[model samples]
Target: MARTGSGTGSGTLLCRRNIKLDSFLKRNTERAVYERIRTYEPCVVISETINKVYMHVVLSDERVYLTEYPPRALTIAFSFRRVRDIELVNDLPDFLSGKDRELCQHIRITYLTEKPAAKGRDWLRRDKREGLPPAAPPSRRNSHSPTIIRTSEGYPAHRVQGEGGTEEVHMLPPTRSASWPNPESLGLLKVPHPPARPPSKPPSLYSLSSSPSISPSPSDQRLNIGESAQVPRRMGSVLSRLLRRDGGSSREERQAELHLYAVSRTSRLYLHLQSSWNSYIIRSTLSLDPLYRRRCSVLSDSTPDKRLPSISLERTAHLFGQLSAELLQEEISVESLYLLLQELRTAAHRNVALRRLFWRSSEVCVFLVQTLEESLHGCQSLSGGYTADQLLLSTLIVQTLAVMFRETEVEAARHILLSAKKGALASRMLLALICDPELQTENQGSLADCELQALLADYLDAACSLLFEMLLLGQEASRCSPAENCVSIGWILRVIQPHPHLLDFLSYQAQHVVLVLSDLQESCLSPAQCVLLFQRCRLLLACLQYNSQLAQHLRSHFREEFRYSVKLSCAEEKLPLQYPISQPTLRLVEQILTLHRKLHTNTRALTSEKGL
Candidate 1:
């Protein structure tokens, strides 16, 4: 009995071991099969956990696969060829109930008229070298000998004479084959056949010679000839299909579209997640703790990196589209609009390409004009309807426009601004903002909050800078057209007449001009800095030419500073100046001083006559 019991126990253990071994082998075989399949096919795998549910998504060239784990185990696959549309669902569907409905974010895919099953794994293996037939061996024939064979339809054919006097003939189709010249006419030698064992490296399409060759038979001698003939056809078909699949768009365009889609989706996800977290905190005990709130605020207010974030051209276009769409809506979120404008301002300031794109967008230009009009109306209202947020938003808009105009070519900027529907209205609104008594430098000290005062000052600076560009454009336009000169100059004169503070502000900006000119004389400056200084000088010259009183004010109050700046600018270079750029700047400064003196003298003479 003991012996029988031992034998039975040993058998049981053996059976268990066999079963475990079989299972292990099966798992490894499955893994190896999957890895082999993935080797030949390019795919993107994304692992995400949404609403406590883990999901895996696989994207292949032709199809999409989605798998959900655990309690809600589901797997779905669909081909891109069958997809009619893909929609991003922000709100919960009716079928999703309870917790699922509240937390789920899903993609809704619509299928075409006939939805077919996705292609098998073998489809991806088509490009593999192992799937291709081996190349045939070349026939043993005299180098000078040529044999011509004809098909039943009388079309010309090529014949390869093999060993044992067995001849194989390849018929050339009459229509397309005529384009290929006879091998003998080209004076080409026969290609050597591949060896019995296939080469480790795959054959390249370009390796095939242009001469006509025989098709392969069941025998190995003709294999290479067949492969060379078929490779070009197969490659051509593959490329055509890829081009068609992309719907005539280039690869770069498709990539840009995908990038924009990914960015928008990620932004939505982040916003949703942040909102959910905030709501959870509000419902929990953390909301009531002042210390926690303060800590959160401190973290939020921590200094960010000073370097600007890198942005692509596609992202800038996407931002412009979003802003235009939002502005077109009847009701827009102030915070969201401000954030978008802030991002655009940063992008425009950092990227010259983005600035040009921004200026070229006529829709954006019109929308900006409309926004300025609304802000102007609010500011001019009797009820004091312009809020701090509106002021900030306007400042961001002006700053972005100022950067665009400053960096872009003057003619392009002028043309774009004038082409907009309400272009002139923008200038009027800008003047109103710049001339607002509440935002004047003199009134800045009355504000208790220094930050608010600083913000107003920045807004004033941007407004003044943009207005100056517009005035330059108007001056050029005046030289060309008498009517435009009358309109632009008349409106500017009318606006300036009502607000003498505008002249004071111009005088204040002249201080910066003095400092920049003095710095230019003391040390070498970059070409860009020199250009900026030249622009400032031109603006000062225009101010002097336009108003004799302002020139008199400068001569009386700031005469010594002006004289010193002019003297420093005229002195021979201590440090070498960037030629051409700095030379023009120096010449402009001399012109400005000459004009200032002439205007100041004329004003004094006119004042003496008035006293008499």
Candidate 2:
């Protein structure tokens, strides 16, 4: 019996050991298999790693998507049944190419077909699912014990373990998205930082127990960048459509619309510029850029070949078209025209090389002149309402002309005086006012018409008078070279012959006398070469036969000078005189007196030799 007992004991011990060893081996084998299976399971790549795959387990997603299939939620459950121990997910991905490996590391997929369990709507609530066990009912707890608020739920909704561990706190966020009040109405909101520790005394409702709420200050608040400005915009209706591309707009199909948009924008810019009158707008609003300049240069009959497809100036003929369209309306203002001239003058002054610009550049001068000419012409015409713009422009243009042409260095005054073959408009306006006793002959504003004379007379006289101070002023005023002066003077003299009554055009009574005297004086101012001046003046004076009284008055006025001139002529001839000194030039006054005395005595002899 002792022997059998010993044998039984050994068997029993051995069986126990065997059972334990089997359990151990099974556990090890299972762990090894789990590790291997984990390699094949789907995972996500949290970051790039040489030989590792890190992923976040997405439990569920409520976001709706417009697509064929609902996205599968991922979980951390894994198994390693197929192979021995494996360390990381990426190490096994060596068999995969770049994209496959990326896919393997960046996606979550379940290997098993079993669907994931879904949580109920109370998933976010703490009371039923995440809270501690409920406190004992009143019957179960003694009233004396502190009222422990134990909840029947499983675990605490929020718990802090250590620095590395945290728990979620459930509370309302200050701003609940778009439903929140406007940041502006709230006024300069300030965010308060949380205290280091909660107050010993529980905070009042006003005191903050939780993290401080953050509110951006007024300045820091986001601006609605693309919203309409405070002043409501007057949007042009989209009666037209334009092509769009890549969440933007396209101009290809909407050519007309695009052009319209451009025109509107440009027109608006012009109006804005006009209204604001800012220098920056003036400088950059319209570029003296090629387009504007070319538009200015466009001519009515411009040829396509000669036209630059896009240049800054226009052909001279088309200048009228290119002016700021706003200015072309029924009533152009004096202020506007003055401003325009300022712009032109500014451009000319600023550009030193304007001549190279050719035809268009010349148009600047032509444009200005024509505008002034037309405006005045218009104001004087029967049709125009006689706006003062023309008169104002005239004033400005005259001043501009003086400034612009003063540098020419040419002495054109003499040429001007001599070229009065019907006279320039400026000259005519002056003369018509002077001679027309009623002056109502037509189209003459006494104000504008008469002012021209005062300006020219004063201007010429002042210039000549200044020369007198310089000691170069001659009694008659002709320092001009005969060569050039003759061209203009000959015309003046010739015009008078064909148009005998041209003298009526002189602006002042004194102008006529001055004209005659001027001719004589210029001849004397430059004696030798201008000798023809005297001859011309003499012939012109002789043409005043119908105005004999006026002619005789002139002769009497220069009587002493005339007497000396004739006597000297006769002396030079050294000839005996047959008649009196007053007959004509080249006659001696002395001979006239002597002949009168002799005629008185000889009258008795034969009723006077003169009577014969």
Candidate 3:
């Protein structure tokens, strides 16, 4: 009996050792399987903290997993459906320092790109299918229960699942669950069906459910066994609609409610190191900005400089040609053109050399002239006048050109404009735009349409400024010959005679000229400066010869300033003239005075004729 007992003990010990070996092998097998799965999955190491805690970001086909390494205690999961945008940033945060600062690049992840799915009739139906108590029949259910309406085909229209060949439909009320009430109990009558017509298409399952015309009643409709068989045919269609509505959420709403997350610098470095550790395991999901990358590379290779990097002349010409081609073909959108012009304006405003380069392109110059002419005609076109976008675009174009011309040598700039093809047509268009009576009308429209009117005013101002610059150039060109000045002066006189608005524009310009003269008189003058003043005076006198009212207005308002400037200018040059005005200037002023007297005489004669 003792030997038998010892043998039993040895057998029990061997059995226990075998069980322990099996448990050890099972654990190792599970670990090996887990490691294999992780190797195939796409992973991104976000960061390793100073505490030696590592954060691992893993991207699956439809979800993202974030987990803490070592302890593996914390985990967060996100659905890809919620991801809106992913942006890579090179800028590091200021707070990070040392190893953490050197390790990571920034990544911005945007979420909540769509609205959350609402728990509606589908959810209730799902709950009922998943072992919940069956809902009572429509006839016996409380008034608070959803109403089930029947379609013409006698199928319940609500989105309820069929059980044992029985389908039920329930209507989704407008209000929340607690406030639900029978729509028919509110005294609503059943909607009459339209006249029966030939079936043009297969009937939709949700058609009766969504129809506002249908009203539920106490009478419950049950599908016959034959009708229940047809329910399966519509199930496919119903599920497809649901899937599409859920999966393809509207991007507009997502864009309106996007959220962004920026990973720290250390996290970025960790991601970089992790990617390098296993290139195939962790690949970038977002594309890098080529322009930004190129800029960074260039900066790193070159010496640091505070000044903004200058665009090459070749690049400027290429861009100008592209813009010109787009404008000529009318292929570019107004917004796109405006944006491009804005960039050009900013560049030209900052760099004088860029403006010079722009003018040197003959194609660009011609394009500018053509664009101005088209914009002017588009604004004034009687049928289908320019849209708000086009109006704003025209204003931007004019503003950009004005910026290019501003503070530059007037003679050179004018030469560039005149030398281009259709340049003369551009000037004529500017004059016509300034004289257009419609542009001078008071703003009259709803605030929505007022933007176009405001842009119209800005366009007119820009046009006037550009035209004045051109005229100044003309004045410079005609300085050597008084006769040459008549051609331009005569053209101006003829253009203004028919348009009182043009006369007003000239008067406004005359005020600016007087102010400039006043400023020049206060400062010591160079001979060249004195010559420019003389030319300005000559141009003003020529304009005054056209309108008696304008001439009188200038004389009354600026008589002292004008006289003082003339005397100062003549004295500075010591001109061979006793009169304050030079001979050419005096001749121009005398002609203006004669025109004013004749205008007065004509007015008096008209008044006498009316009295008779």
Candidate 4:
């Protein structure tokens, strides 16, 4: 079959046909503009301590444009999610600026009903359908707007009779009212061009401003009497509907609720969120460590700069304490908290001003332990389905404790001793996590199951660092008074040794300790760090005591760890031995153990030997 007309022809009034489509678009755009003009939605307001969010109202799937004048060099388009509090209400002039209100007024013209081409419902039938336009004022509401006011100029004069038998007639003024469309005529069908972008403002505007006629009536629904009246082509322009509640459970409702939440930021929950975020920041960046002065406590007599980075620890603790209370009551956002913490930690590390946070990592760790334990006490879990982040936090905290002890060893040991019961908890959590690791470790198509290689590596590094910090810097002489650490180390090792092949678990430990001899060779070692390594060497030598020797290759392999431990331990050094522990080596080991024992027994008297 041959096609007739593709909306084009010589005798074709294509523009007239297209005009209806444009008219529909033009009407809807006006309603949208009128809606905007009448309502207001405030974006930023003080909620919690301080929070700001924006609000937006979507009208019939229209394309919006926003251009940045400064052409911000960085950001592309901003993304807005359905935030959790904000709103847009229909009180147009109430929320917008004077200029915006003026712009919105232009909408009333195009929004109302259009004039009928022919009378009767049959006008919408068949061949006329192709040339047919939007149905005329079949709906009563369309008769009230500006178009009716314009066509009224050609109508019969209003008939009136005076009390004294005198007759009078009058012509009405043009109305400036929002083009009200018949509620019934809306029919739920969407048009292409929205009432958001009114193109032309016809006439001097309707004079129906003060007393707007909103309700429908029987006389208003009648067919045109004689001369044709231009029907206002309205697109259901009911401004109040946009602002009023449409009952419940729609996507818009949810989005609006979220927006409102964002706007009203001062709730207790938001405060708690901010505090929680701060705590995470501390952990991610700052590697826990004793004070530099703690490092100097051996030579405490020599240096004297003790002023720390001015963070209010007491305040932070109080805040976290409150947060923990709220968080503990429910199965809270554990994973999100964990991720936020990680990011904050990273940020803190990159900025040195944040390093003092590390000095206070001990306090942060304590707060974390307290919060988690409290939360977990009565809080329920999904049978055996434990949280990956919770376990990660435990492991990370342990690693932090280990490093904090690097300078002042006794503090670490003291912490372990004090938290013995909790340390037990840590062990349990960590073992469980290892049972089913979380991080991705493979690059495969399905990507469903893989090792958490990166996380594993970090955990091990932390463990090794902690162990080293404890054995070396932590002794009878150091500030790491947590003696439980030394006792727990052997137990923890035995427990973990079973999974020794778990991503070079034992090898890192083995490699680090055996490399101690060369680390002892460092002449500029801090006596505490040096002796820490030396004593660690002795323990490592003990681990390798079965059938091993601290050879050059072994020493070179863990050069950094060995050097760190020895410098931290501040132990006396012996000449290099290109030999494994033969019988002679046994004697050497014996001598080293005696010195190590002296370290365990009388830590203070040997302070003079730290820098050597």
The clash numbers for all candidates, in the given order, read: 5, 25, 5, 80
Question: lDDT for every model?
Answer: 0.39, 0.26, 0.37, 0.29
Between candidates 1 and 2, name the one with more favorable TM-score.
1
Worst 10 residues of 2 by lDDT: 254-263
Q: Per-residue lDDT tens digits of candidate 1, residues 294-388?
A: 32221111112321122334655565566657656667777777766665654453334455566556667666667765664445434443345
lDDT by residue for model 2 (1-612), tens:
000112321221111122332232223222211111101111222110001122111110010000000111111222111011111122223333454433332111111212112134223234464432221122111211211122233211221110011112221133543222222221112233232333355322112101111111111221111121121222321100100111142212110000000011101111111111111222222223444333233222123232212212233213323443434454767687787654443332222112112122333444444565565443463543333444456655543432232111112232232223433432332222221212232356677556654444433332222211111111111222333222222332333333332343322332322333332333222211122122232332432322433344434344344334333333323322221111121222333324334533443566555577
The best candidate in terms of lDDT:
1
Q: Pick by TM-score: which candidate is best? A: 1
Candidate 3 regions with alpha-carbon error over 4 angstroms:
1-306, 311-315, 318-330, 379-387, 407-426, 432-445, 482-501, 504-542, 545-612
**Which tens-of-lDDT digit does each residue in 1-612 have in candidate 4?**
001123222111101122332233344333322221111111221111111112121111111111111110001011111111112222222223465432221111001111122233322122344331232122122221211111223432221111111111222223522232222222211233211222244311111111111111111211111112222444432212221222132331111111111121111112222222222222211212243222222211112122111123343334334433443445557665554444333323222222223333444545555644443222424543233344466455544344333212112223333335635534543332232232322343332222334444445445444454433322221211233232334444444445524234445545444444445355533323333333344445534332222322233354444434533233224322211111122343455445444433443444457745
Q: Which RMSD does model 2 reach against the true structure?
A: 47.4
Q: What value does the lDDT take at residue 480 in candidate 3?
A: 23
Arranged by TM-score with the best first, the candidates are 1, 3, 4, 2
Model 3 Cα lDDT, one tens digit per residue, 1-612: 000112321221111122222232223222211111111111222210011112334332223333222111112133333434344445433334566444434443434423342232334343445332232212111211112233444433332211111122233333533122222111111323333333355422111111011111111121111111111223334332333444444433332111112233212222222222211111111002242222222221122132123343455546555655665565776667666676665555443445555655555656665666577654554544455665676677776676455323321333434523423544454454453414432445767456666676566556564554545334333322333232243444454456546656555555544544444445534322333334445546655654455565666665555555433343334423322223333344445445545655666788899999
TM-scores of the candidates are 0.40, 0.21, 0.33, 0.26
Cα error, candidate 3, residue 101 (Å): 75
| After superposition, candidate 4 runs with Cα above 4 Å error | 1-309, 319-329, 343-398, 401-452, 470-504, 511-539, 542-612
